[model samples]
Target: MGRNTRKRRTPLATKIVAGAAALAVGGGGLVWANFYASAHEDHGGHNRTRSAGAQVATIDCPDVGQKIRDVPDRARGEVDGELATMDSQITDAYQRLATTRRAQAGDSQFVQNSILGPLKDRRKAIIDRIQLEINRAGGRADDNLDELAGCQGRPADQQQDGGGQNGGGQDDGQNGGDQNQDDNGNGVAGPVADDFIDINDVQPNSRNSRNGLAADGDGGSTGTFTTDCGVNENNLFNSDNLIAAPGVDNGAHHTHDYVGNQDNDAFSSDEDLANADTSCQNQGDKSTYYWPVLRLQDGTQEFDANDQGGGAEGNIGKILKPAQAELKFVGSQQGDVVAMPKFLRIITGDAKSFTNGDANANTSWSCSGFEDRQVTDKYPLCPEGSQVLRTTNFQSCWDGQNIDSANHRDHMAFVQEDGSCPEGFQAVPQLQVRLAYDIPTPTVENGQVQNPYAVDSFPEQLHKPITDHNDFINVMDENLMNEVVDCINRGEDCQ
Candidate 1:
């Protein structure tokens, strides 16, 4: 009697309903667990990505950019080192030359010696090479500096983001309540927003104020937020836009008259100025301009013929005459001295009637004439105690005396008006003229010769004459030899 119902068992419909409800609850739990696992996996998978992001952030540091931008300055230091080395070499050469001159002062063999020719030539070549290298290095440094300056600012296109949220629901004040569900019946959060990140903040490799994220739950939600962590403004790798520090302008070539003058005249033929302008254009400087001859010496004046008071054809002599005349006139009138013109030109309408003296008389004087009277065997003797004497036995004579064979002569002047040899038609070696008169003995110092004459020390003029061509070639060879030796010692490329 306890209930015929218990004996009869539960109805089939009721059992089926209970089983279905249990299955639905279990399925909901499984889905929740899967969602949690997915979130965790996403975080774990992003470890490498986060690490990369951090590295990029560090490079973005403003200091790193600044450091990279300083490359030109660093290069300049290297150039300075090279220049110092060149300077040392030049100094050594100069000192050696000075010492040699001193040691050879009283020695006849040394005084009239041609030993320093090769060394002199080498010095000039070295100087030219060093100057060229300096110019190249300086130009490179300037270009690099310009590139660095352009990197200082931000990119043209920038964006902002707010992390993983919807654009609505903040005003509802529904704390922890799922007022709205996504397509999958999951609760959705309101929009997350952030402020703009400043460059200073990002300079120290800190996180930027623009952080964003995407999440998938019911439908999907994106999260965006900003942090105050600074940007890496100093990262040279990332900061291609960083500005570089400027360099000091050295005075080299700044005071050269030709360079200054060329800059002033628009019609100047200087190719260097044109090259400079082109370089400026390539650098994207639309407004860049240069003016030449910026400053003039005191008391300097420019005259224009068109001006009313420009005075007397703009002649320099006329302009300076007043001051000069006053001084002369005052001296003559008050100081009992005649004030004569500093310079005078005699004007003769006809050459034949200019003077009463014999025009064709042999007025030319000769040192050899004096020497002949003093020495019997020597056709032309030099003055007593003369260190070097000119000998006519050589190609060209100096003041009627024979040219010295050993001395490096730089220039020669003939006693006669015309530089031609006597009508004998003797073939004169032009090289002898240069070697005897062009180069001068090196200056001597306290009883010692510091720089012994080398094949490379000849004057530039000595290289020109056809007869001296071999000597010139020899000098060049000696220079090349020395340079090759130096290069080998330093482990540098040598030709």
Candidate 2:
């Protein structure tokens, strides 16, 4: 556990643009356009993979899983396992980089020849196995996967906004300021002073007017249902992700705070989840909700301080429990919403947004009293007495059939700018989570940060707030799910 009294200070880089006027409405309901540079494409694949760098801070590889689509159901299990192995390969390679910092300083090509080269060879072998599994299952695997096997090193000083911090492509965002080594104090890299901005400096970005909808007898489902799931006061923490890497231990490479269903790990089957106990006050709602734990980068060491996903991997500090965890389900603005299928799983935001870009980034940060103002890529610096808030609005549109997908994202879709479900998709009750933390607000002065807070993340991600994400697996009982849908359709607020 982390001690609240621990005091540590981190330094920051110079400030960038306050906030970009990035939100706008077009024919769609609401549009958050790409205000910063996206991850490098043209790697001969769907997405680029990033790695640990020397002067180059990290590695960059191809995200093979994102490109491997339409696999036969029988092959998905083996393919998923191979994907997990690839992630492990990267983690191991990153460890090599961190430990050999001395060698990296002396040898210019040490990272490329010794670290990245070996990782690529390992990844190539795994990519072959993934393709074989799909082919054996009678699915046509893409031949270009081999091209993605090659990984490159990123310059530590190379600045471009993607992971977190910045709407206007600024090199100052997260380039580690003037420090040459990881100043985050944790053994790993990132959350440099450049990664944050004062919340009060951010201008208001307009959202949909219908977002604050009330029960006015509109065409849409105007009601809401709130579930009382106590914050993980039971201390349910783990680094496993059953949805993305089933049967794999420490797949996430970072610890998560789990709430709702008590039995949620890499091995929990749908049946196991249905029968598990829940933290929610309502026994009928056994859904599992989890997210990366937020930690203050103080000197206090927690349980995982020496573990792979914890301090060993550079995610040190004390874990802070949320002061308030409010889970509410609301209806679609277009029409009445249907009940979500049981066992439905949704992952909001990208855990690799730092390297993968903001295409899938959906996080929001604000101060408790300044809820009207929100920032997606930066952590909010709340005013004194005002707590920090992290909010996530899950995708409300379902593909109508599958409860999950190959990439764990294809089954669900966010409502379009017009606030309507896409063609062939059904609008489901949208889950909105508001998590508030009562930790001391971090302050930056003279290029130094005092008591900073960050979400646990993959070592290479550098604890970027944009990489913060959430997970949910709906296991609500049929009767209770019906009650939720009915309540929303009726425009009544029921808890």
Estimate every model's Cα lDDT from 0 to 1. 0.18, 0.72
Predicted candidate 2 versus true structure: per-residue lDDT over 404-457, tens digit per residue:
887888889887667787899999998988999997877776655667889988
Per-residue alpha-carbon lDDT of model 1 for 48-165, expressed as tens digits?
A: 3232111100000011111121123224333333333322332233223222322322232331132233333443454344344445655322223222111010010111112211
State candidate 1's TM-score: 0.13
Give me the candidate number with maximum TM-score.
2
Error of 2 at 295 (Å): 0.5
TM for every model, in the order presented, reads: 0.13, 0.83
